[model samples]
Target: MEEMSVKTGVFGGTFNPIHIGHLVLANYLCEYGGLDEIWFLVSPQNPFKQNIELLDDNIRLEMVQAAISGYPRFQASDFEFNLPRPSYTVDTLNRLAEAYPEREFTLIIGADNWAAFDRWKSPEEIIRKHAVIVYPRPGYDIQTDVLPPRVKVVNTPLLEISSTFIRQAISEGKDIRYFLHPEVYRIIAEKKLYQK
Candidate 1:
């Protein structure tokens, strides 16, 4: 009999502080989607959103590591750090495919990103090459009627939390203890991060 292949899910983002929303989504995707593992790819820089004050990539990665320590299926990857900018999803997917030929990979994204799929680099090529698993965002709706055949809209619960809101709360001196993991919160408080 042929060896059973591992189904891996790739969840890429800036992950400035890796909050509860990210962890919840990963857990949901792993359990409900039957994924073997979910890798959180931390982007060095996001092409969109110019005004966001991002923490250092290394620091962000560390926070993500601390936040996801208890989850056995969750992993943090820095694949985009050495790649050229602006980091295009298509290129990353291609590289991943080449690097891991035996395992099946799925791109995990939110519905809001899927709505703007046309704007991404080589969108058609990306759709042609890999499987896309899209989860729901707070306000975005998935319209499969217009999407490509390989795209799959997953029924994960929509969590209203966002890194933007978390950062804003921190900058304004509001308590964001509940929004983030306890370890992450402790690190942020100790480091005096996000305070303007």
Candidate 2:
């Protein structure tokens, strides 16, 4: 008898501060996307965005850990941290494939990103190598009919909340209690994160 293979989704993001919206989407994907697990790849650096006001990598990683602690199927990975700067999704996916041959990795992205898919590093290769699951984003229309066979468009409830919004709210000393997990919010408050 052979061991069962795992189907995992690679959800890469800055996760400057993991929030309720992120948790909700991940949980939904696990159910609808038919994934065995969802790995939150906390990028130490994102090439597309400037590093201005970015919190420390370890702190960001810790927040993700705190947010997803109780979920058995959700994992926080520091895989990109060990890699070189300007983490690209394709490179991360490639490394994961090599590291865990038994696991089939799917890329979880927002519909907004799908519109800019061609601009990514070797987008064609990424599509050819693994599955891409795109979730709904407010104001971004997803046309799965135009996407590749491996790409799927799922209609997850649009959670318009964003990390940027939460960060800005925190810096302004505004209440963001309802936007984030209790543990994550507590950690941010205790560490005084996002407050210059």
User: Top lDDT: which candidate number?
Assistant: 2
In model 2, pairs of residues that clash are none
Model 1 bad stretches (over 4 Å): 46-52
How close to the true structure is residue 46 of candidate 2, measured as C-alpha lDDT?
Answer: 59
* Ten contiguous residues minimizing lDDT sum, candidate 2: 45-54
RMSD of 2: 1.5
Model 1: lowest-lDDT 10 consecutive positions: 45-54
Candidate 2, residues 84-153, lDDT tens digits: the string is 7777788889999999999999999998899899999999999999999999888888876688999998
Give the candidate number with the greatest TM-score.
2
Q: List the residue pairs that clash in candidate 1.
A: none
Q: Please state the error at residue 176 of candidate 1 in Å.
A: 1.7
State TM-scores per candidate: 0.92, 0.95
Model 2 segments more than 4 A misplaced: 46-50
lDDT of each: 0.87, 0.90
Error of 2 at 143 (Å): 1.8
